[model samples]
Target: MTKPDNPNKTRFGFETRMIHAGAAPEPVTGARQTPIYQNTSYVFHDADHAASLFNLQSFGFIYSRLANPTVAVLEERLASLENGRGATCCASGHAAQILTFFAFMEPGDEFVASNKLYGGSLTQFGKTFKKFDWHAHLVDTDDLAAVRAAITPKCKALFVESLANPGGVVSDLEPLAEIAHQAGLVFIVDNTLATPYLCQPFDWGADLIVHSTTKFLSGNGTSMGGAVIDSGTFDWGQNDKFGGLTAPEPAYHGLTFYETFGDLAFTTLSHMVGLRDLGATMAPMNAFQTLLGIETLSLRMERHCANAQDVAEFLAGHELVAWVSYAGLESDPYHGRAQKYLGGRAGSVFTFGVNGVTGGYEMGMRVVESCELFSHLANVGDARSLILHPASTIHRQLTDEQRDTAGAGPDVVRLSIGLETLDDLLADLDQALHRAAAEGDKAAE
Candidate 1:
């Protein structure tokens, strides 16, 4: 076991941070890799120490639900990669959203969100949020005027995705952040699709970021995890908007998070309060797996982007194809935004459509079923190719207008490009599309 030189003070490049940030050699055995602290509880040295840990006066492993050492390493590593002050890991992407909202919202408050987002997120915001009397105003985030108009006195946050999921629109972050700031609302960007490898939303004025680590962060799709990272620049105490952070926490004997934790107030409260009670905590083993995935993120993303470009190009010229919606394409409407925020790559997951409404739907399904290499699954950001018709699967809960507005129309098929060789991947699409076209031809009779 080799002792790593000071993980806390270590400063390196993005790639280096992805691999070594927050990762220290094991104190007991000097293990080079982060060890999974799978135990449920940690021993408190004395009565004073226990009180200190419980009161948030000191930071140490208290319980698995509150925080685990292995998960803490992952949280720190991801926060460093994204240039955030700190981060908290959650059980799933949806949990991250809920926990983040818990920091700035109470019953009856509303927030503006992008209409075009992952299907699961739309459901979470549209349906689940209603249960708590919280509301989500889903609008076109691309429309600056609409976003500005949507904000109300009760609005607490502006939420949008940096690189949208199936829609693949590269959101205009700079202006939207300004709008949120002007209205005294927190700006939260879901950096799931682009990951930290592609886009850093905080640099574009976003105050906080959320990610579905289950997707790209765990590049291999081996673990289920999510994260909420705070830029630590949002002055929660600057205004009366964030009572949850600036006010005394009843759970912690009136400790105001912003007064005590300062820049890290959001993440600290999320861990001590939200995660403690909600219990949507990431497992130590999953965190360890996500750490392993982060180690190869840059490499995987480079290949994933290149492969996606190739796939998108191949589909665009196909006779059966109608339109493609990846920002990586030079002709894409979002190309400029992608260049500005995503550093020239539109990201891996994108949507495309075939010709007809009824016929196109059949062809899209056939192509998905015919694919021998690309899997027909709901997940994205895997090292392997994936295909799904979002209209019937992920977006089945929404109405026709909602589905169409979200770019999940009946004729559309979403693709999550992977790291497979260019030739083999192209051949797979060719076969799938051909089979799909043949099926359509037979149906015409």
Candidate 2:
């Protein structure tokens, strides 16, 4: 195994870290790649070692649910990529959200989130989270005043997507983070769409960053995983709100996580308490696959962004398209923000409205159905292009107002541009749009 010289001491570049961070030559065979340790349990050194592991007195793998060698490597790499102090890997993105909230929020506490979020996240926060007495106030983040107004004494955090899904809505992170910090609330940014390749949330003052590795992080769409990376700068002991971290725990014989783990308190709590009790552990195999996927993330994202820009430009000029919501476009509302945060590369996943004689829903559906190249599915960030009518699919459960607010209206057709030949992708979309327009014309008559 060729390893980076002084991996721990040297500050390697992002590309180097992606391949070598949190990894070393296999002790037994000197393997170059990270091996999937698919065991459920690990052997304890002795009786005292077992006790220490159980008591949270020391850090060692006791159960797969709490921690695993494969998942640990994934977590460390993600933290390094995000420039975070630590990270915890879980089964899915939703699991990462739950683990994050579980650490700081008690029952009846609340958080504020941008109205523009993933449809599943909207459902999770607005509906399912209510069942647990954890409330989320969805507000338009563009209205900074509205965001501040939404926060109250019970608000524990402020959440926003760095680059919102379905639509390419670029958030102004610096201000939002300022708002959260000024109010003594944790600022959580979901960087799923932009990925660390395009935007690093921690650099913009985000205290915690979340990702559904199911998307860009696992570019091939083969692995399902999520991660919550902690900046490890939040002062959990600064206020009484984070009792879960600062206060003594009954489960661990009164170990205060903030005191014991310091900057890594959130990450430790996620593994020790959240995963241990919630049982949303990331499979070792999934972790291994995701790690492999991340190896080519920079390459994939560069291609993804470049291809999406071309597609978006083509659609903006096409007769069958109404409007394109890609921040890469110069006319986009979020263009300046994208330039500031994403270095002018506004990710691959974005939405556009299809022009129809009768209605947009029908035309959008037709376009999606007629697409020969883009896969018709709910997923985004695949190596292959994907298409979906979010109003009828992902956001079908939400009200009309919720759908529109989330940028997934009846007129919207979301596209996840892939790393395909630009000419081929454009040709596919041109045919799909014309076919859909003709279908709509026939229906109108």
Candidate 3:
């Protein structure tokens, strides 16, 4: 039987694509939603067909460890939303990072990444990646000179968060992309914070985009998934550094991915090699949940940003607040970059320092514990508002200097604004601030 052509082949707006892209009524059951293909393995038509699937000559699922129908829809939808040629979905955002670098780096390879990133990412690059003999040079990406100086011959890529988590620091993407291309390094952006609804990193010359779809893309805190999308513009054959793509693969009967797959080489290699070996495939049920979440991404993001702006502004003026670092505010250092890259929406997740009589750590904890409206949790991008004290929780492994630089300092409280009534959010925060202050005063006495 011949494959049926996609009805959604025509280009559409992001909002439309979010709902309709990569999906058609189930061929057999006429289901409108992408149904979960929960089985572990697929039977091939014949030995010839099985050989083709195993050899990567055809794109079909052989095992759940590599691909699934439900996850494929999520990958396609993400690729459409990001305006990229292809995407690969995995178990979580961290898995997405591992898959992306696995495609490029061999042993003894190096990469440069922005120092300001999710605390987990910093630890992954600086610590876990070292286990693979892959070294990372963490640098202040804001300083172009420093970034240039950090890139040596062994460096394979440059990584940065499009909007640094918790810090509200918006990266200057265009110049950073230029710098990466000049140094012949692949540019990778973690777009978890600034979802495609707010900023499309591919629009600014990014070669690759990664997302912890567990966050904004999933939106409701119900699913865990990650994705890596390829722009399909990088020239793997330009140099032999990326042997995984350009060189022959002994496992697949001397298949040269770049020569055979062309624009899809990296994405194909990611599935055939990365997912096949690493086994970080996303579950079909999780993909279905995420697809449902993504359907209303634009709507949720607009409300999230608006609520965050109001909350940030309210905190900026609160007597017990030391500082707020949301780029939506004009006084923020990265306000200009936010305007250029994120359409002036500085995302909903940001940090503010709590002013305390003794120390920020104590006051910050009090404020978090005092909030009634916001749920105190480690996760973000929920339909409900969430809060965290990063220094004690997410950034606990980092040293004092590291936490401060990443904007997850002792006094910092990170807020993930949700679709709550603006007045209620304000009142809740206001009460929390005063309550914390009162408690701090009693402690002093």
The per-residue C-alpha lDDT of model 1 at residue 39 equals 82
Each candidate's clash count: 0, 0, 0
Q: Of the pair 1 and 3, which is ahead by lDDT?
A: 3
lDDT (CA) per prediction: 0.90, 0.92, 0.91
Task: Indicate the TM-score of model 2.
Answer: 0.97
Candidate with more favorable, higher lDDT: 1 or 2: 2
Q: Which portions of model 3 miss their true places by more than 4 Å?
A: 1-10
The digit string of per-residue lDDT tens for model 1 on 8-125 reads: 2245789999889999899899999999888889999999999999999898988999899999999999889988889999999999999999888889999999999888899999
Pairs that collide, model 1: none
Candidate 2: Cα lDDT at 243: 98
Candidate 1 lowest-lDDT run of ten: 1-10
Off by over 4 Å in 1: 1-11, 356-358
Give the TM-scores of the predictions, in the order they appear.
0.97, 0.97, 0.97
